[model samples]
Structure formats: C-alpha cells, structure tokens
Target chain A: MTIKQIERLRKGAITLLMLAISILFLLPFLWMLSASFKIEADVFTYPIQWIPAKWHIIENYKEVWIGKFPFYKYYWNTVKVTVLTTVTSAFVSALAAYGFSKINFAASKYLFIIVLATYMIPHQAILVPQFILYRQIGFFDSHLGLILLSSFSVLGTFMLRQFFMGVHNEYIESAKIDGAGHWRIFWQIAFPLVRPAVATYAILRFIWTWNDYQNPLIFLRTDKLYTIQLAMQKFTTINGEFYSLIMAAAVSAILPLLIVFIIGQKSVIEGIALGGVKG
Target chain B: MQKLETAAEAPKAKHISKRSSLQKKETIAGLLFVGPMLIGVTVLTFIPIIATFLLSLADWNFIAGFKDIKWVGFDNYERLLQDDGFMKSLKNNAYFLLTVPIYLAISMLLAILIDKHVYMKSYFKVAYFMPYISSIVAVAIVWQVLFHPSAGPVNQLLISFGIDNPPKWIADPKYALPSLMMISIWISIGFNLIVYIAGLQSIPKDLYEAADIDGANAWHKFKSITFPQLSSTSFFLLVTGIISTFKIFDLIAILTKGGPISSTSMLVWHLYDTAFVNLKIGYASSMAVILFACVMLITVLQWLGQKKWVNY
Candidate 1:
C-alpha cells in the first residue's frame, strides 16, 4: 500500500475503533433505557435483549410514576429542594464571591481562605454533628431543611469568585461613583457580569441536590417528605425484585438530568473543565 | 474673611467625608456580601468540625439530651486502633483507591482517541458522562438489575462462555467489593475523561507536529510530550478520584448494604453504619475525625508532592 493510502486506512480504522468503544462504554445506559421499556420477564431474560420484544414503555413508566408508590411526590420534593437550593445557593455564593473578589477588606481575604479550606473537609466528617444540629433546630426531615443545608456551598462560592475576579474593577468603581451602593453594585454590575458562571454553579447545584443520597438518607425520615434519593432507596430496596419497575423508576429519576445533560452539554461539560471540579 | 476660608475648607471636608464613607461602605459591604457565607461556614462547617472533634472525645449515642454526655478523651481514638471493622473499612477504602489508576488510564486513552479522531465528540462525552450526572440512587438501582444473580446479562454472558457458577456479583462476599469498585470506576471515568480531554486540548499542536516530523512513534510522543503535559491534570484526578472513591457510600447503600460480611464497607459507609444505623455516635465521630485527618493529610502530601513532581 502507498504511504498516503496507509494513513487513510489507519484513520478509518481509528474511527471504527472509537465508534465501537463508545457504544461499549454506553452499554450501561443503553441497557438501562432498554430495560426501562421492557416487561418483568424480559428484563433479565437470556441472550441480553437489546430491545424489548413487547414494549411496555407506558405500562412501566405509569407503574413507576403513579402506580402504588406514586413517585411524583418525591419528584416534586426533589424539584422543590433542587430549585430552592440552586437559586439560593447561587445568590448567596455570588454575594460571597463578589465580596471576596471585588471588595477590598482584610477580613474578606482571611474569610475566603477559610471558606476555601472548608471545601477540603468532606461533608461526611461534619455530617454527624450537622445531623444533631439540624435535629436541634427542627430542620430535619423537611424539604426546607434540605434547602437550608445546601443553600450555600464553598465550591460554588469559590468557582464564582474566579469568575467574579475576571470582571473589571472599573465597572464596579464606575458604578460606585454614580452613588450605587454595595448591594446595587453587586446586583447591577458584578452579578450580571458573572451571570453565566452563577448559572453554571446553579445548574450544577440543581443536579447535585437532585442526585444527593447521603443527606436525604440521614435527615429525611418520613416518606411523605422524602426526596427522590430517599424515595428511590425505599423503592429499590423493597422492589428490587421487579427489574422492570426498578429500571422504570431509575429512568424517571434520571430522565430530567439526562435531558439537562443533553441540552446543556456544553455548559455542564465546560463547567467541570473550567475548574476540574465535578458537581 | 470667614466666607473665603469656609469656601476653601468645604471641598476638603467633602473629599474627606467621601473617602471615609467609601472605606466604611467597603467594610460594611464586604461584611454584608460575605455575611451569609460567614454564618454558613461557622454554623455548618466550622462548628460541626469542632463538635465532631469534641463528640469523638466523648461517649454519646445521640439519644439523650446534653446532660447525658460523658467525657472520655482519647478512649474513642484508642478503640479505633482495635476496631477491626474500622481497619477493614480503611482497607476497603485503600482497595477502592485502585480505581484511580484504572480511571486515569481509561480516561487518558479515550480522551486522546476522541481528541484525535472523533468527529462527533459531544455524543461520546454525554454517553459516558450520563452515569456521572445521574442520581446515584438511579445508577445503583439500574446496576442492581444488571448485577442480578441468576438471570442478569453479565452472568448470562459468562454462562454463554461456559463458565458456570459465576460469582453472584453484589451478593458474593468475594466479589462484592470488587464489583462495587468496578461501578465506581465506571462512574469516575466520564468526569476524568472530560477533564483529560480538556487537558489534552490545552497542549499546543506544534509539539505533536514536531514529533511527527522527527518520526517519533506514538508511544514516545505521548510519554515525553503528552504525558508530561498532562501531569497536573492527572495529579488532580488522582487526588480527587482517590478521595471521592474512598467515600463511596450511596452505591454500596443501594446495591450491597456493605454486603455479605462488610466486604464493600468503606470508610464513609462504616461511619454511616456506626453513627446512624448502629447509633454509636461517638465511635462514628472518631471515624469521621480519622477520615478528615486522612483526607487532609493526603491532600497536603499531594499538594507538596505536586511542587516536586507535577509539571504545574
């Protein structure tokens, strides 16, 4: 073969290999999706059915969504907690980020370092104490509790601070000269300039709170107040025998985030790339 | 004379007031903006840490009021030495650290391949990253279905290959931890892959072109250029992946419940089981303290090591 022809052939070969491997890496998701639409008997049946023979998409989804357990309540609970936490956390973290990045105060520097240091301490370390504190404050088991607990994150503050720093000090100073106060300056100038970063952190927070298992597992007690993670835990442990139901429930849990992942693929992916920090 | 003097002093007085007001506003604004976070940090993070440390030194089961507490300094720490479960959990966490290399290697390979050849990168990125973004509860449940003992596809595939009596994955005492390790690695690959891709793309193209002109092989080019360039990213992934995987809890909680004899019981899971499930709050607090110290120590070591070893 000619050298140029050899290069073409190698390129083709690499493309083919990448395609096959991508599919293989995607097998778990494919399996989950396929299983989500399958009946109970066909779910684990031999030869690995890639597509269900008798598609039970509606039946399976309906069963998981509103059937005996009615997962919608937990879904709403999750939605409420996620939205509240995301907005509040974004707002609160942005405020802190602005203070740290824009304000010239000695304590801001020391305080930023403390917040950054707190990021290193795993949530589990303080988990027990927080649990006790939450109980004491009557914040446990309520969606409000979840909202309050996750309302601000050091990671969010830190990530947004990096963006806040990118905003020109000129803008804030100019705004200040116009008699804009601190709140007005942060609100009108700094916050909007870093809106995209704030949104990124908020979107990430939404996903994180939605996916959080540890907090709800500990704090949430009553089933009525359980988040999706807590609800899914209960659902799966009791109903794991029904692969179709569990898979369907799994589908319900992931479909929204998957949609978000697909639609906001660039932002979400870029968000991680920005800091090398995963939500 | 009084009017002339007052007129001159008015501007100076206004300038001084403006400067003072600006300074005052700065301090107050700084305090105002960072106030919520300061409170959160103190209330949620700082206090809890002190409370956890103090709780570790005490004997409390979390059932009684403040009066029920019994101070027992160093006793919990002493018990941790003899605690076989805690040791096993640490061992499991150490075992879990093995995923870091696997994650790094796979991420590097896939990242390089996609960076070089893949025309449609987002498809592969989202496909691999779906599990990472999805709820662990959802992932666990789906994995549970996949790891089902008798009829699961994994066993069915193995059975087709004629290896009968395939170990029941999550249920098998021997394979449970390893199986969970596999899942954690799978979940980790997506994030690391994206990070690795970002790292690879940051490398200047001329380095590769020069290598091509020199007739250097792919392996050599990667070793000298790509690998060295990726050291910082790899170091980051290494530190983070190890720390995160060591805290593996949700998957184990949903899939195996630390399984057939605590095989999959990790440090975080052990802490959960001790404090929450078993209600040994003080003991679990000690475990928490140990876990915190270990994470901090490792992070400090890695940060120090980066100065010497990592490129950036």
Candidate 2:
C-alpha cells in the first residue's frame, strides 16, 4: 500500500481503539440509566439485558418523588444550601480578592500567606473541634451553621485572588483619579472585569457544596434537614430490598447536578483549567 | 467642617495630605473586605487547629464532665505507636498511595489516546467524568452490590465464565482492601483524564510538526515532546491525587465501614471511627495530626523531587 493509504489505515485503527475504550468507560452509566427503569426481577438478568423487558420509569419516579422517602424535601434542602453557599462564597471571596490584589497595607503579604496556609489543614483535623465549638454555640444541627461552614472556602479565596491579580492596574488608577473611593472602584470596575472568573468560582463552589456528604451527614441530624446525598442514603434503608427503587432514587438525586453540570460545563472546565495552571 | 479646617490649620494640610486619603481608604476597604474571612480563620479554623493539638494531649469524653478530664501528654501518641489498628491503617494508606500513581498513569494514557483521535472526544470525556460527578455514597453502594459474593453481577459474570467460586469481596479480609482500591481507581481515572485532556489540548500543534519533520516516529515524539510538555500536569495530578487518596473516608464508610477485620481501614477512616464511633476524640485528634503531618511531609518531598524534573 502507498504511504497515504497506510496512514489512513493507522488513523482508522486508532479511531476504532478509542471507540472501544470510550464504550468501556460508558458501559456502567448506560447500565445505571437502563436499570433504573427495569423491574426488580430484571435488574440482574444474565448477559445483562440492555433494555428492560418492562419500563417502570413512571412508577419508579413517582415512588421516588412522593413515597415514604421525603426525596423532594432533600432536594429542596440541597438547593437552598447550595445556592446560599455559592452566592455567599463568591461574593465574599471576590471582595477579599479585590482587597488582597489592589489594596496596599502593612503585612499584606504575610496575611495572604496565612490565608493560604489554612488550605493545608485537613478537614479531619478540624472536625472534632469544630463540632464541639458549634455545639457549644448552639449552632449544631442548624442550616445556618452548615451554610456558614461551607461559605468559608480557602480554595475560593485563592482562585479569586489569582483572577483579581490579573486585572489591569490602570483601571483602578483611573477610578481613583475620578475621586471614586475604594469600594466604588471595586464595584464599578474590578467586579465587571472579573465577572467571568466570579461566575466560574460560583458554579464550582455550588457543585462542591452540593456534592459534599460528610459535613451534611455529621451536622444535619433531622430528617427534614437532609440533603440529596443524605436522602439517597435514607432511601437505601427505607427500600432496602428494592434495588430498582433505590436506583431510581439515586438517579433523581444526581439528575439536578447532571443538569447543572451540562449547563455550566464550559465555565467549570475553564475554571479548573485556570486553577490547575495556578497550582 | 470648620473644626476640621481649624485642626488642619494647626498642622499643615499638605503634611496631613501627604499620606493620600486614597491610601488610607484603600487600606480600610481591604480590611473590611477581608474581615469576615480573617475572623473565620481565627475563630473557626486556626483556633480549632490549636485546640485540636491541645485536646490531643488530654483524655476527655463528652459523657464524662471536664472535671474528670485526665492529662495524657504523649500517652495518645505512645498508644498510636503501639496500636496495631493505627499501624495497619498507615500501611493501608501507603498501599493506597502506591496504587494511586498507577491509576493516574492509566488515566493519562486514556486521555492521551482519546485526545489523539479527533472525533468522539467529548463523548468519551463525559463518560469518563460521570463517576467523578457522582456521589461517593452512590458509587460505594453500587460497588458493594456489584461485589456481593452470592448473587451480585460481578460474581455472576465470573460464574458464567466457568469460574467455580468468586471471592467474597468486601467480606473477605484478604480481598477487601484491594477491591476498594480497584473501585477507587475506576472511579478516579475520569477526573484525572479530564485534567490530562486539558493539558494535551494546550500543547501547540507545531511542536509535533517539527518532530515529524525530523523523522521522529510516534513513540519517539511522545517520549521527547508530549511527555515533557505534560510533566507539569502530571506533577499536579500526582500530588493532588496522593493527597486526596490518603484522606479518603467516605467510600470506606459507605461500603465497608473500615471493614471485615479492619483490612480496608485507611488512616482517615480510622480517624473517623475513633472519633465518632469510639468517642476517642483525643486519640482521634492525635491520629488526625499525624495524618496532617504525613500529608505535609509528602507534599514537601514531592515539591523537592519536582525541582529536578518539573520545568516550571
């Protein structure tokens, strides 16, 4: 064969290999999505029936939504916590980032390093003390406590700081010459310029807070306060023997996050890329 | 305003104005903006960490009053040194660290292969990343079912292939930790792949063209060009991956609860069990401090290692 033909053949082989690899990666999710709609008896059928003999999608979803498991309550709780944490974290981190980036002060560098050092402390190390302290303050088992704890992310602070540093000094100087105070300059100039970064951090913080299980598990004890993950765990116990129902509940719990990710993936990927670069 | 003018008259307004109100105002705004975070770090994080250190030195149980507290300076650390469970956890964590690098390499390979193919990139990317986005609780539960010895799909598949007896995965002390490792590697490959793909895409096409012009084969080009260019991404993945894997707890909690015979208990999982289940808060705090020190030491060593190889 000619060189060009050989090259085409090689490319075809590589594509075929990639296609096989992709199929392997995708198989479990396909099985999960398919099994969610299957009858309980059909869940473990041999050779793995790709399609369910019977579709129980409606029944499964109905049970998941309004059954003994208060799945909807969990969804709402998760939504509230996630939204509050994301907005507050983004706002606070951005404001702080502007301060660190533009404002000159004594011991600023030392203070920034101290903030960065906080990132290195493992969550496990702080759990006992934090739990004890929160209990003493009567904040334990309260949504406000969880929200407050989630809002103070060192990663968000560092990410926003990097973005704020990238902002041009000229804009702040121009705003300064106009007799605009520091807050005015921050709001009018820096905020708009770094809007993309702010949005990126917000979406990421939302996903992280939404997916976090340990904090919610430890802090939120009441059934009413359960988040989606905690709710999913509760679903398992309530319907311990019903594999199909549990799968359905799991699907419902993940669906919102999947939707959010699909919608905001571009910014999320960009933010991760930027974060990796800084690291 | 007249009083301010009179005060300014006593001292030269120029001298007073030498330090720009702009500077003072900016300083105040900076403090105001960072104020909440500073307070949080001091009260919620920094103070708690110091408190943990102190708590580790005392034996205090919540059920018992503070009046009954006992000072156990170095006793917890001594027990930790002699405790078989703690030693087992440390060994398991080391095994976890060893296994993680292999998984990360596999992920990098998968990412590079997918990146080389021009089509179906996003399809593979999303598929690989699905596990990363899924809850660890869900992942662990699903894997637990899959690994069931009697009727689970994995064993059933093995039986269909003519194997007589499949190992009871999470139940058997021998197979439990390895089983956990396998599932972790499977779930984590996707996340690292995403990072690798991002790194691969950033490389200029012209570098490959130059290699091709020099009569370099695919393997040679990959070794000299692709791998070198990807070193920074690789280092980032290695450090973060090790850190994350070492601190793993949720999967162990959901699946094995530190196990059939404590085989699957990682350091963090052990720490959790000690603190929450056993209520050995002081001992658990010491374990946590040890874990923290281990992580810090590893990170520093990795940084030093990177100085020899990592370009930037």
Best by lDDT: 1
TM-scores, all candidates, are 0.96, 0.94
Per-residue accuracy of model 1 over B63-162 as CA lDDT, tens digit each:
8778889999999999999999889989988888888899799989999988876556777787678778988888877777678788778888889999
Best by TM-score: 1
Clashes of each: 0, 0
| Interface RMSD for candidates 1 onward, in order | 1.2, 1.9
Residue B56 deviation, candidate 2, in Å? Answer: 0.8
**Chain A vs. native, model 2, TM-score:** 0.94
Q: Residue B213's C-alpha lDDT in candidate 1?
A: 97
Model 2: native contacts recovered, as a fraction:
0.50
Q: Give lDDT: candidate 2, residue B257.
A: 81
- Which tens-of-lDDT digit does each residue in B3-105 have in candidate 2? 9888878667666676777567667777998888778778889988998898899887855756877889989999999999999999998888876788878
